[model samples]
Target chain A: MSDHLPSTARKPGLTSSAPSVVAAELDPPTPRKRKAPGPRHEDKRVAILRTAAQLFADNGYEATSLDKIADQLGMHKATLYHYVSNKESILYQCLVLSFGNLDAVMSEMEDRSVPPLQRLRQFAHSLALAQNNVFGRCLVLVGSRPLDMMPGGEIRQFQRRLDETVRALIVEGIADGSIKPCHPGLVSSMLFGSLNWVPRWYQEGGKLSIEQVVDSFMDVLTSGIAAPRR
Target chain B: MSDHLPSTARKPGLTSSAPSVVAAELDPPTPRKRKAPGPRHEDKRVAILRTAAQLFADNGYEATSLDKIADQLGMHKATLYHYVSNKESILYQCLVLSFGNLDAVMSEMEDRSVPPLQRLRQFAHSLALAQNNVFGRCLVLVGSRPLDMMPGGEIRQFQRRLDETVRALIVEGIADGSIKPCHPGLVSSMLFGSLNWVPRWYQEGGKLSIEQVVDSFMDVLTSGIAAPRR
Candidate 1:
């Protein structure tokens, strides 16, 4: 990412780059209404989540329907009501599943007394892992929504908690004099932003292991190899 | 962004940090959404772009609709047909407008035979500027859709063109011994991914200038601050 290798070259590297994105806070007119009733079933719940994630991934959240999801699962439309009450619930659940793992990773970091910088490396690894899963797209889509979803809501506050945790981690690093004192928010943004965007360009069965990618990212992100005196 | 800040006396200085989004593109949605064909055409066109961008940004491309857009605009459903024939057209226009300026930025950078590294700095700045606007969200939404709008579509070809362009730029620096020979794809992704996600966090009336953010990004991005010792 350094400057001045040359002004012109043979190929554009990441030039085709574009960002990509979910959910049921959408309000299109309903085509049909069905009575909401069903038993609390577990398999049905899992099926609903799995189906909704696909639909949400494919069609976006607002355009998907409980009926369509029900149809995909080969179940009655009303039967979906028993498993998940509304499309919004499905949206929230998909989000919870995606972001929930992030919280777990951070907590695990807390359990260790690793130095601040090492902890940051742990964050990069965990973040890459967390964002690379099925829940990754769900996380991107859900986070894109600009609505003031209830501040107290789990999804909304969950991000806040995560932000605080990341910031605290960065702060701890700075205080120990092991990290740079640049804006932690910007640093955090750069850190997670790099990880958050992995889902956009990364393919599942590709050349580099997740570990190699993490190391490369850390090399560029943390300690640039260009010696100042040189 | 260092790795060794200690854990004690965490006299946190980054607490006031608010994550700022240095997104990739931000444009008002394409002009006119009224499909019904009627009075105040100009107003209607801009209105459609406004509503559609919000919907697409919040919802997703396939999920947002002409009808929902009209409803958001407070215009009749049929009125939307006048401005755009369909959602796909709106998506294309929204994106084309977002990309329109990029071509200009590259051209501006071309006038001066700046060092390849400086050219990259200029590239990063222009990209960061594009993201600071309304079109950034538009790019993110439409960029995700897997569209084949034209027969023998060059979406694949255009992406190739873009890749070639970036690769050439990077290779120039490498050949000139100005930058290292790293994975161009990974570097490209890291630079863009970090820049594109800026909108998700940055507020319009924030403390930092676009250049400040850009330089900071380019600093950590291009050359890490770790001073080397003998």
Candidate 2:
């Protein structure tokens, strides 16, 4: 997660090692032998998602078609359907992967041993770094707007959980006396706004490294820009 | 700006009293005495833009069409073209107006009479308020992705200018000893990320008013979320 890979190498997947629900769902059941999807099958699904995410990020989701993704992947459109149902499904999977990554960050935030402010900093750092990846870029840039008519409220639920995680961290910080008394909801929005906006302007080979960017954000978040009074 | 009206009343336009460049450019060259566009023409043009902006914000720029905008405005598609050449033109005009609003904030920030920190707060306040409007929602939500094929680089220029304005404010704040030492470029990005993300989650009549939102943002931005040192 620390190393921001180039476009081709940026195969964003669920942070956990287990096969994702997307991977499981994409694989059709065979009556003869109901076997777990092999590593190769999982790899292909991830690759399809990666390519689609890059295309979606480069071209608007509405503009990027399944045919384009297949062309990018050097696969037939039929073969592309073998991996995902449609463009929206690919987008849904990308978001699933993205929210999974955030869930991992939330787990870190839940570590009571660490100070709440420190955990919040870690959350910001991890989130900004995550945005450097293609899937994260898709989540931020392409967004869930294209998935408006898609069935299932999983995305909305994930979004609500993400918001709650940030708000919870702020509430904990306030209770622990590490953070100032502030509206958790408003502060959470500010934190997300700053972190989520990273992908819009952050470049791979830009002058400032992702670490530097995250550090600057942390400084602004913790100490703020106001000069110390005499 | 303080009054964030409902969708119908949210007719976002150029902040300046003078007729916008978009309005002038939209008008065709007449062979007869070339008089300035009348108030009725400007009103109709603004109405078209406002209606189109709402559609673009609601349905997205890609999904929206001239026909849909026309249907929304109760005008024929050909009549819609009378005011704007194409959907891209309408999008470009919306962006033009949104940036024009930001340019107004930039002008306010340029007032050296106010403290740099105060000016920075004003920038955040004005910017968040601007996001409550339909055009601002178009800029932040739909974005300039669909207009990638559109010829003019005006949007890019406006974006660059917006970045510079924010950076200049941070630099000024630092120079005046009002702001702590920091990377102006990175800080500007953080500031913009926070403000721009407002349109995504801000509701018209949500629990928090735009004023409360802006105020909370200013608080987090000025005073670090961290509790005071012993």
Task: Name the top TM-score candidate.
Answer: 2
Candidate 1 similarity to native, TM-score = 0.70
How far does residue A192 in candidate 1 sit from its true spot (Å)? 2.0
For B13-129, candidate 1 gives per-residue lDDT tens digits of 111111110011121233566343233554556556657876876666666767788888888877777566667656654544444355555554554377766777788886777
In terms of lDDT, the poorest run of 10 residues in model 2 chain B is B1-10
lDDT, candidate 2, A1-230, per-residue tens: 11211121123323442325545543546466767678787888888898888888888787789989999989999988876777777887777666545667877778899977677778877777667787778888888877777545566776777788878988887786777777888888888888888888778997988888888778777665233544
Chain A, candidate 1, TM-score of: 0.71
Please give the C-alpha DockQ score of model 1.
0.26
Cα interface RMSD of each candidate: 2.6, 2.7
**Least lDDT summed over 10 consecutive residues: which range in candidate 1 chain A?**
A13-22
- What is the alpha-carbon lDDT of model 1 when measured against the actual structure? 0.59
DockQ, every prediction: 0.26, 0.54
